[model samples]
Target: MSLLLLAPALLLVGVVFLWPLLRYAWLSGHAASVLTGLVPLANGGANWQRLLSDGRFWQDTLQTLRFAGVSLSLELLLGLALALLLHQPLRQRGAVRAAVLLPWALPTTVMALGWRWLLNDPYGPLNRLIQGLGGSPYGFLSTPATTWLFTVLADVWKSTPFVALLLLAGLQTIPPELEEALLLEGAGPLQRLWRLTLPLLAPYLLLAALFRLAQALGVFDLIQVLTGGGPASSTESLGLYAYLNGMRFLDFGYSATVMLGMFLLVLLLTSGLLLLRRGWQGTLR
Candidate 1:
């Protein structure tokens, strides 16, 4: 009876998730492009082989990992701090949270465009400020050395609020008595956070980590709108590469292969996190 109750949801999941994955796997083995008249032709491992040898693909993969790693770390750290601040009793807490969430709530394209203008060379506000200070206007979006860093900063700025909201919920779940008891025993703020609050909040932290890791790995829109994987492709991600192959280069087969590669990478990382979650749960028991 329970299985019957879950059948519809299970079917939906298969259709929405499983089917696309299966299709990509199958398509990755074929040749489908303008050369092939846009019809899928059995290519038998050719696409995968090309992917293995493609230097650009591997470079993009590395860049994606770096982007995800750095963004995830900063977002988690800053988010925790912001969450802690919000957890305090303050005037107009609701309004404060709304303001904090504004960045995350805005459309990604809108935010990306805003950042692009802010960092634009010569005439942008940042450049104008530099010029005012007797410094040359910096080419933020054009310089390979600084472009990727700005992308990371933009991502962190937009995403940190989301992480803060998750951690704030976790903070609320913690009982006030736990902190009160620690305070009575002469425990300081940092000590109570380390010993009591953090331990209780471990599950929530892990949850947020998993969520951010997955999102960071699959980041697309921000990179697309903000950087466009520019400045000699220093910031190109696997998703952007796949997108270019499929949409720009008209290579469907290779695009499918790239998508599958990204899927495998995400699966491996998320699987590790899941294993860690299990181990943590076992330790709790």
Candidate 2:
């Protein structure tokens, strides 16, 4: 009876998730052809060989890693700080928490577009303030470095609060008796945070990191809306590259290969993080 009950859910998962993945695995082996959708079932390893040998593909892959690395670091730090602030007893605590979450709650595409306008070169409020202060106007989205910075900023802005909320929940779950005991023992705020609080919150911290890093690795909307991989593909993440190939260029075979590669990379990264989390928990024990 239990097995039968699981059958529908299992079937749903296969239909929705497993089927598409299996199809993509098949598609990844095929090669995109100028003649049609794909070259007929390709000779063994042709797609992987090309993917490995392609300089541009490697660059885009590295770009994706680099972007995620930078964004994740920023978001984690900012989120931790915000969570600590919110964890304090303060007036308007509910209102403040809601305000902090607003950025994360906004639709990503709309938020990216909003950031674009906010940082617009000539007419943006930021540029206006810069000019008011006797600085020359800057085309933020037109330069590789500036565009990357803007994208990172937009992603950080939107994601930090989510990290904060998770950490705040963790913070609330901590036993008050432990903190009071620490205070009675003359532990400073920093000491308590580093020695007691963080040690206890390790699992939740790891969980937040895992979630945030995965999202950062696969983020698409912010890049698409803000930069469009512009300024000579400087901000092109793997996801965006695959999207353009599949949707814009109609190179579904190659796109599927890229997607498969991304999925594998994410799994590898996540596995490593999970291992680290286990090690951390062992250390805590």
Candidate 3:
């Protein structure tokens, strides 16, 4: 009876998600003409071969990793700080926490547009502020380094709030008595954090990191709207590259290969993290 009840949802997932992915992976090995319906030919492994040999593909992969790494690191740090701040009792804590969600709640496209305006090379608030501070107007999206920096900043801005919220929830689950007990034992704030709080927060932190990493790895809209993988392909990410290949160039075969590659990589990475977390939890037990 329970299995019958769960059948609908399972059928929906199989039809809507698994079907398309399997179809795409199967088609990715075919020739472009076959994909476009111009001819029927199975060129096994050609798409994957081309993708593997493409320097641009490797470059985009590196850029994606770099962007994810820097953004997630900063977001984790800032989120921890914000979570700690909100974990304490304060009169406006509720209001502040709600406000923190604004960035995360806003649509990614809108946020990207707002950031684009803010980082505009000419007549933008950011550049104006820089000039006012006796610095030259800087190119944010048009330069390689600046593009990466702004992309990281945008991601961190939108994502850190979510991280803070997760960590705060974790904080609430922790019994207050633990901190008080540590305090009574002459533990300083730093010592308490190291010896008590962090240890308890480990699972939550790992889970949060896993979620953030996946989100960061798949980032597309913000970078697309902000830089469009421009300035000599400096800001090209795996997502954007896949998009360009699939939609822009109509190279569905190659795009599918890229998508499949990304899917496998993310799956492996996430699995590894979860395994590590499980091991840690077992050790703690």
Candidate 4:
């Protein structure tokens, strides 16, 4: 009866997500018809072949992982700090929450544009401030390292609040009496955090990390607008590269393959991380 009742949702998933996913998977292994713009019936390993041999693809893959890893790490640390701070009893807490959420609530393109304006080489307030401090005007987007640094910073600013909100929700679930008992025993704030709070909040932290990791993997707009994948295609993520291929170069076959590979990699990594989280939770018990 449960399965029967869930039939509608299953149908919807098939039509909206699974069907298209399967169709794209099929297309990924086949060549696109040049004349008709349809997928050919014959299988062509050309797309997959290119991916295996392409150095640029490997570079983008490494950069994507690096960008996502750094940004997610920063977001988790900052978000945890914010959650801890806000969990305390304080006046004006509501106002503080609102201010913190403002950046997260803004559209991503808007945030990216704001960062771009701030990082402008010649006339940006940041550069002007540096010039006033007797420092040379820096090329924020002119190098791989600096361009990626800003990309990670921009992502962390926009995403940290989300992580905090999730963690704060988790923090709220803890009993206040436990902290009181710990205080009576002369446990310091740091001690209580390590022994009592961290064990409890680990699940939430992992959950937030997983969410951010997924978003960071497919990051496109911020880096795209900031660097246009240049100073040498150094900041080009898999999503941007696939987009350029499919739309700009009109290589639908290769683009589809890239998308499929990306999806599979994400799925595998997500599953592996979740399993690790489950094992860690078991150890905690």
Q: Against the true structure, whose TM-score is highest?
A: 1
Q: In terms of TM-score, how similar is model 4 to the real structure?
A: 0.95
- Candidate 2 vs 3: which has more TM-score: 2
lDDT of 2 by residue, 1-285 (tens): 998999999999999999999998888777665546456556467777878897778888888898898998899899999999999998999999999999999999999999999989899999999999999988999988657878888999999999899999999999999999999999999999999889887877888889988898898999999988888998899999889888888777788888899999889998999999889878877
- Tens-place lDDT per residue, model 3, 141-243, is 8877668888899889999999999999998898999899989999999999888888888877887899988987887898899889888999988999989
> Highest lDDT among the candidates is held by which one?
1
Against the true structure, what is each candidate's TM-score?
Answer: 0.97, 0.95, 0.94, 0.95
- Between prediction 1 and prediction 4, the one with superior TM-score is 1
Candidate number that wins on lDDT, 2 or 3: 2
The better-scoring model by lDDT among 1 and 3 is: 1
What does the lDDT read for residue 3 in candidate 2? Answer: 88
Reference-based lDDT, residue 23, model 1: 95
The positional error of residue 199 in candidate 3, measured at the CA in angstroms, is 1.8
Clashing pairs in 3: none
**Of 1 and 2, which scores higher on TM-score?**
1
Per-residue alpha-carbon lDDT of model 4 for 1-285, expressed as tens digits?
A: 999999999999999989988877877777764543754654678779988898888888888899998999999999999999989887999999989999999989899899888988978889999999999988887877668888898999999999999999999998999989999999999999999898899989989988988899888888788788887898999989988878887777777888887787778778988998879888887
Global lDDT of each candidate: 0.92, 0.88, 0.87, 0.87
